[model samples]
Target: MLSYTGGFVLLAALLHASWNAMLHGNRDRFLSMTWMSIAMAAVSSVAVIALPLPADAAWPCIVASGLVHIVYNVSLVRSYKRGDLAQAYPIARGSSPMLVTLGAALFAHEAIGPLHAFGIVLISGGIMALALQGRHVSRSSALAAFVTGVTIAVYTVIDGIGVRASNGQALAYTAWMFMFYWLMPLLFVTMRGLPALWAPLRDAPMAIGSSVVGGLVSIAAYGIVIWAMQSGAMGAVSALRETSVVFAALIGRVFLRETVSAKRWLACVVVAAGAVCLGM
Candidate 1:
């Protein structure tokens, strides 16, 4: 079961990195993120219709998770704007699992075995190394990325509890959360005027395509994490999911044309080892 969960979360990590790369590569990241949210909400709407409504207990979590995700999106855009993907992405993603581990123990009464705890430490350390080993990232970007990481941990714990409260309808909880989370981002984008918001889509075919595909990838990635959390320890699942930083580093070098040093590649190797520990 642990191996299966680890494998799925690793897949989610790859998908998560791919979408982040797409967002980082776009000209107007905020607008691109808005479009991606719309696509996610649209795709999730179908799942919402098909799945049973999450139990009443899950609604509060769904709403809370949605609000937190808004902060996450805004912070991520700010972080990406201020720094390179390889740096900002690792910091934003790497800082979360530790927070999630503590939050899970405190709020959800989830116990972490010694091996799992070690794994979380390794993953977090490796991720931080990826950020620190490369060219220096600005303080503002690092701050924004840290804020983004906090939001990720918050929503992750919320969704973890929420999925269990979903009365065996984890899919329903995930779908509803995704569907409503876009409302604020959509409104924020619309305030800039429809013309401004739609300009990227109108002018850049690649932008529009990436936005749509990113949305799908984002949803799938998160859905897998949520599903894994249903039966797996939230902390372990979170630690595994955040291995996305490794993929993000690779994507940064290859696609985004960013610099990744040998030390950072070594950091990626450490993260993979951490993932192996979790899978044990």
Candidate 2:
């Protein structure tokens, strides 16, 4: 049976796919992403104020995660530029869990049982097949998606350790991390003159709407994942999170009207089985 934390992480996986689907439709994806980050920072500010202060030990991890998140965002943007949303998102999400599992095992010294290891393999393989299902993406885009996965792995392991060290205040630590998540994007946009940033918004009201909604969803999604990570195995939690790829495919079919093939549907089943294995 799936543990309660596993169940919650599955919930988070769905939310994660929802927000990313919203994001994929943005004409000015970078700007929409900026808006999402700004929205997250704004809400996180409230969380920081309302939640109890994180212990001093958590600060180091918060700082490290903030820096790493910049690369993650940039890499994601690059991935989008190179490939279609359906392809890019799955590649990034699918590749991440395996890397996270390995990182946890080697550096964090987290022990994984054989079943969890097989689950990670299934997830990675299924997602890889799903990512390659659609129109061919540029190699550069594929590389960027792979890099996004790596960055995700790094930050995830960092946050997993940091959250555990927080004792019971992991939420506050996450709040602070979200508060700074927008800094890198903000700086890049500002460099071209802040006016250039908002100029794109004038033409794309729908993108703006998605940004606001996606922003809120992403913040809550990560918050839930971080909370689960504190109690669950980071490797298991990370693998379960990638099941978002299955949801992404369905979202693409339903809302985006993209044609998803039957083979891809089978891949989704493989991904689901991996997630179930992790939960067990």
Candidate 3:
């Protein structure tokens, strides 16, 4: 990976964490997510218009990515509703990088050394450790989070590949994917028994403000990762991007007053250490 691209990817992670914290802090996650998605679509559409469409080979992947992202957003909002951001964020983000690494190894034939293998295991362990709730979590909450984890893993791997396959047209694909991805969510919110879908917009100014901020952060995050994929290895970019989980945990603790146990802190350290090893 190019040093510049890696740096941008890290910045993207920070932005991603910030937006996630905001969503977690919100009184209505579904409303925030819906607005965020709309904002993402609008911003991405405008930015992507400056570039040409991706190659034919990228379209299928782009479409598939969009579909997966819809599921990801739904799962994420549900996870946030059920669990603390610190705990749920770690598990959801922790699961992805390892899955991306495995995908790269199996399909892209990237050679994995013992250190890399060990890093993946440590990351996964750390994530699973964070999954345990404070013993007050309901069984249904646990189940929903687990299902969310699966969706996260699936979407992360798919997007990693999709970005890589964009072949230097990462921005175009991101724009298209973000635009297309909102379709399902929009349809669901409008048609799926939610008469209150428009309720959040009753406060147009606040709605617009939150949507714009959330969307801009999201656009920056996705764009930087796409650019990173163009110049760097997908697995490495994905792994580095997953660092946002740790950042989110800190944000949650400080801002959201979300509790973090010593074990969870240690887990975060382990994941960071693994990332360091991978970086070296």
State each candidate's clash count.
0, 0, 0
Tens-digit lDDT track of model 1 for 113-145: 788678777877786676566447666777888
Q: lDDT tens digits, residues 195-275, model 3?
A: 556655665557546755886788788778766766565567777887887798789889888887787788877776565
What value does the lDDT take at residue 132 in candidate 2?
A: 65
Residue by residue across 30-139, what tens digits does model 2's lDDT show? 77778888888888888888998888888899999988987787788778888766677777887787788788888779887888878888887886776666667566
> Looking at candidate 1, what is the lDDT of residue 260?
84
Off by over 4 Å in 1: 275-280
Candidates in order, TM-scores: namely: 0.92, 0.92, 0.89
Clashing pairs in 1: none
Please tell me which model should have the higher lDDT, number 2 or number 3: 2
- Please name the candidate that would achieve the greatest lDDT relative to the true structure: 1
Model 2 Cα shift for residue 257 (angstroms): 1.9
lDDT of 2 at 225: 86
Arranged by lDDT, best first: 1, 2, 3
Provide the RMSD of all predictions against the true structure, rounded to 1 decimal. Answer: 1.9, 2.0, 2.4
lDDT of each: 0.83, 0.81, 0.73
| Residue 79, candidate 3: alpha-carbon lDDT | 85
